[model samples]
Target: MKTGKRIKGLMACLLVTTLMIPNVAYGSQPPYSDKAIQRVMGKIYEPTTVDLTGMKVVDQAGAPLNAELKFMLFDTTIQEYSPEVHANNGVLDTTTLIKGHHYILSLADANYEMKNKYFTLDATGELPKDDKTNKNSDSPERESFDSITVTKREQTLTEEELKKVNRIPFCDDNNGAGKFVSELSGTVDMPDMADMYINDYDVKFKLVNQYETVELTVDEFGFLQGDMIEDLNYAVVMETTDPELQNYVLLQDLVTSKNHQEQGENVLTRTYTHYTCNPIGGIYLADSSYEEGQSMIEDCTYAPLPSYSKKSTLDGIRVFIDRGRKINTDMPGALFKVFRDEFVFNERVLEETDEKLVMDFDTINMHRDEICKLPHGDYTITTTLPTENEVQAVYNVDRAGNKVEDCTFTQEGSNLSIETTSVSLYNTVIEFKHVHEFEKIDGTEPTCTTTGVNEHWKCTSCGKLFADEQGENEISLEDTVRPLAPHKYEDGKCVVCGASDPSITDPENPDPENPDPENPDPENPGEGGTSTPGSGNISTPGSGNASTPGAGNVSASKKGATAVPATGDNNPFALWTILAFASIAGIGSVVVTKKRKSN
Candidate 1:
């Protein structure tokens, strides 16, 4: 036993000595130094420096990298990892990365992107096989450090960056998939409702009354969005909330038996769906199929009613069933009128509703790795998204996160769209004011005096009386002002004043320069007036003959006992006879004087 123990001890010493030879004998090696890089989830880290300069790789102590973990590469290792990198398919297998080489790991579909094209030299070197084992390691780590260079690292992503890189829009587009249904129906029994896929009704209303339904369909921009419909299915039923086929039977019967008398009492129902891009309007079938829906065509005739049927529904879109159809452009004038009215309502409601449900989808779609797909070069990335149209905006968030609210990058479904058009603010202003004109406006009726011309006619309300001192067709204002004179004859003289009423007021201080005294109204022509002598007090007869007053007529005296005739023609008959007698006496006296003188 003693001999055995000595031999065993010698053997152990030999084993220890052999293990120490590599570290001590290799004088050019560094002092017991080693390095490692920790890789996780296909990502590599900076190499960890360990004290392995004076030791072999097998002598690594307190290894940060576990020996059982995958060892990608070493310079002298003769092992190879299987599975090559495939850039096209984005598969990063063990063969994609050289073992023991510094590399970067990224979470992306591009993890399989191949490195720059380079040729591999066949140096007749055996790469380390990972499953191989020596006395120290049974399955050695595959090495890549020998021929590898860490020139540059591919860009890596954070958790957030990873989300951006891997995100794809899934069901982000609002599939306006429920446009075939409705919540409200109308009161008109239009048989087209069957072709319109109307099977239920929520609010049935009276005829000609309005009912609105909010349909979700692709708008003019051609994407799923909210819209409105007005009176699509006119009915006159006391509406209920049933979705059965029989919900519209009574109305259908009335419509099938349509007549002028039947119209007042008939009703129908429809369960409205959100509207669609191409509205489900009228349909046309071959004229031969008239017998199929003859009752509907003949009875429920708005125009020359054509038959129709419900066709296939593709992705919730109800395509029409125009079975062997022909064009019906001039279907009927009356039908066109109804269609025009309803279409107006339809467009109006759509315009109003697009503004209400204005939220768009682009604000949520994110840009991804594909954005950087060009050749390696400098670039600046931006993102955009959309918001609600409750506010008028030139800007919005785009499919990416950058603020592109300017709507430049915005597409149809990317913005809160109002409609195919921009709606201006509706402002109806009505102004009320009296248009006064100093004179009558051209083409305006010339107003005349409303008062009557009869002598008894007076405006008792305004306290105005009419005058009958008549003219050819009018009366003078002076005559109209006061009561008319009792007689109509003048002093056989013509009047110069036509209708002007001149007031005769005496002037306080008469002046030749000013026509009026007491500052009479300038508009009045005769407020202050001048008077001249007439027949009274100074009237002379024809050819300067004076008129003497008689006893009862009353004469004036000029300081005389006997009244002198004021007229120059005043003469007495006694004065005339005395003169005659004096002439005879003078003749006789002359004759007598001559006879006496002769005696």
Candidate 2:
């Protein structure tokens, strides 16, 4: 047991000796011998000369470069010692660096961008990657000091120099495979006619794939900048929010460059060009039939046509008329009608609604001299001349007597568009001289066979007809035709004008040539008279009257007239005389027989 204890004491002494001697990999000299390590370990030391040699700037392709640049150091371990340091001949001084702590070396310049490199000055420093170590490391016995160059690339710059430039953070916590943040920038340019500043309107922007919108404030030159998530697949959409500005001013997207990350760019920039349009209008009138009225316009003086102001809106416009040195109602038969001009599809009007007339002439005539409110749109105004006057040529002239090229006139009237200005009109009238020379047309009575005419008057010079003799009311010639009247007949003839009727016949005085067979005459049996005469024999009136032959003959005549229906005959009086004569003969025969009986 004492031998084992002696062996253990020997091993313990050997272990103490091995610990006192420094390993060959750490360094042969004591760590406190270096002033930088002494300062890190809290030991007092004087500063030593820094070693900064044999290092140089290079491009991505490993080519040596000549450029004006700057340098900065960042501490990655316990918060300590971050400073803006300078590089002498492309190498940094290592004497002030802390031992065993990680650092980031940043090389900054306007002409080139250097990526961050992790480095340390002391031999005991730990590296992030096992194989890729910085060139600044120094150790005599470590045998594994393989040096790999950091990648470099050339980059263009803005107008600012290194002092004012914002460089990327070294060993930055906010950068990784999935982390991306960047600035969006653009310039807005407007036409000179807009007369507006970029700050006068509110601008909003949104990403194509994003639903939220962000506000961007532009400076005097319309330069804007904002922070946004970097995206290669998304595009930016920008617009002005003022509702009134949208009417006359519009935004034109000239350049929208997406995929800024793919292009190795930091900020996405766009160019916006704005355009503007104001309202205008014009008018035309022509009345060559009245030369005197035309001369009146050439002699008058009035204000120039009104142009649209910047303050004008879509609903704020006026199209008016002025009668210089004349009464408002001087032109009685003239008509001015205003219809919403819908013929053109300013953008696409015809495809929407097909309606035109807004204010007719009758409504417009009531307010001839008052202010009329008109919207800023396409319009058609029809000016109808009086009956005595005719339109020959229409000219759209300004107050200075110069022709207005913007407005045109047609025979029907004028079509005006109020896009950039306002318009006005003037009119006058003159009566024509004429007289009516009437020719009287007498009326004729209507007959059964012919049409008649009503009394009317016709103008000889104008060929106009009138129902009255004064010729005040005009009528057509066809209105004077009268229809035929019904025929009135008496004795088989028209009583009105003595016209014969073939359908009617007189039975008492029948025509001898074309006698009716149904009417047989008594005097002549073949003719159509009352009946056949004296055909039947008569019986004796009494036993005594039968002795006389003359009395029997008279009685036979009476029986013949009675048998032929004398009451219905046209000569019934002749039949009655025969009956009376027969009666007288019978009485005389009876009286003579009485006298013979008495003797």
Using lDDT as the measure, the top candidate is 2
Q: Which candidate is the best by TM-score?
A: 2
lDDT string, candidate 1, 401-478, tens digits: 344323322223332221110111111111112112222112212112222233433333333333322212333444
Assess the local accuracy of residue 131 in candidate 2 as a C-alpha lDDT between 0 and 100.
Answer: 12
Relative to the true structure, how large is the alpha-carbon lDDT of every model? 0.24, 0.34
In the range 478-595, model 2's lDDT, one tens digit per residue, is 7888898877888778987787666675675466444655534444342322223332242224434233333333322432344344233344587699999999999999999999
Candidate 2, number of clashes: 12
Q: Which residue runs of candidate 1 sit more than 4 Å off their true CA positions?
A: 1-198, 202-425, 433-489, 497-599
User: In candidate 1, where is summed lDDT lowest over 10 consecutive residues?
Assistant: 363-372
Error of 2 at 45 (Å): 99
